[model samples]
Target: MRERVGVYPGTFDPVTNGHLDVIQRAARLLDRLAVGVAINAGKGPVFPLEERVELVRAETAPIAAATGCAISVVPFEGLLVTFAREQGAEMIVRGLRAVSDFDYEYQMAGMNHRLDPGVETVFLTASETNQFISSRFVKEIARLGGDISSFVPQLTLERTLARVRDQAGE
Candidate 1:
C-alpha cells in the first residue's frame, strides 16, 4: 500500500500550541506528516525560516516519536500545491479555528484542487482550548512583555521572547 503522506504548511513564526495540536492530530491520520515552513518574504516573519523550522522540529519530536509517525519539518517557497506535489503528499492539512477561517480556507482549498486534482485538502478544527490562539496574537503579546507561555510551547515561548528582547537591544 502506498504511504499516506500529508503536508501541513504554515509560516509558524513561533509554533503556537494550536499549530501543534493540529500537527498531533494530523500525524495520527497519516503515515507521514511534513510540516512545511513557508519561506514567504512578503510575510516578513519575525523568526527566520531556519529558526521556524528548528522550533517546529523540536516541538513535534516528542509527538512524532510517541505516535511513530514520520514527521519532518521542511522549508518551502512558492505555491503550496506545488510543494505538496513535490513532497509526494496526498493531502494538505489545514486547521480551522472558527467559521471566520472557513471562508478563506475554502477558497484556498479550491485553488489547490485546481492546481492539483490528485491532492486533497483536509481541515481539522482547532481544539477547544486552542481555538482562539494564533501566532500573530502570541507574538504581539510576547513583544509587549505579556506571558505567552499558555499559547505556545515552553521552548518556543523562550525563543520568541529572547528574539524579541534581542531585537529591542535588551
Candidate 2:
C-alpha cells in the first residue's frame, strides 16, 4: 500500500496549543506527517526557525507515538505547495480557528490545487478550548505579564515568556 503523507506547515512562532491540537488530530489520519516549520521572517518570529523546528519536534513526539504515525519536523521556505511536493505529501493539513480563517484558507487551497492537482488541502477545526489561542496573542499576553498558561504547552510557555523578557530587556 502506498503510504499517505501529509504536511502541516506553519510559522509556529511559539507553538500554541491550538497548533498542537490540529497536528495531533491530523497525525491520526495519515501514515506519515511532516510538520513544516516555515521560515517566514516577514512574520517576525520570536523563536527563530531552528528553535521553532526543535520545539515542534519536541511537542509532536508524544502525538506521533500516540497515533503511531511517523512525524518528522522539517524547515521549509518559499511556496508551501512546493514544500508539500518536496515532502511527498499527498495533502496539506491546515487548522481553522474561526469563520474568518475560512476565506483565506479557501483561497489558498484553490491556489495550491491549481499549482499541484495531485495534492489536496485538508482543514482541521481547532478544539473549542483552544479555538481562541494564537501564537501572536500568546506572545502579547506574555510580553505584558498576562497569563498565557492555557494557550500553549509548558515548555513553549516558558520559552515564550523568556523570549519576551529578553526582548523587553527585563
By TM-score, how accurate is candidate 2? 0.98
Candidate with maximal lDDT: 1
What TM-score, computed on C-alpha atoms, does each candidate reach? 0.98, 0.98
Write down the lDDT that model 2 would get. Answer: 0.93
lDDT of 2 by residue, 73-153 (tens): 999989999999999998999999999999999999999999999999999999899889888898888988999998899
Give the clash count for each candidate. Answer: 0, 0
In model 1, state the lDDT of residue 141: 91
What root-mean-square deviation over C-alphas does model 1 reach? 0.9
C-alpha lDDT score of every prediction, in listed order:
0.94, 0.93
RMSD of 2: 0.9
Q: What is the Å distance of residue 158 in model 2 from its true position? A: 0.9
lDDT of 1 by residue, 86-168 (tens): 88998999999999999999999999999899999999999999999999899889889999989998899889999999988
Worst 10 residues of 2 by lDDT: 154-163
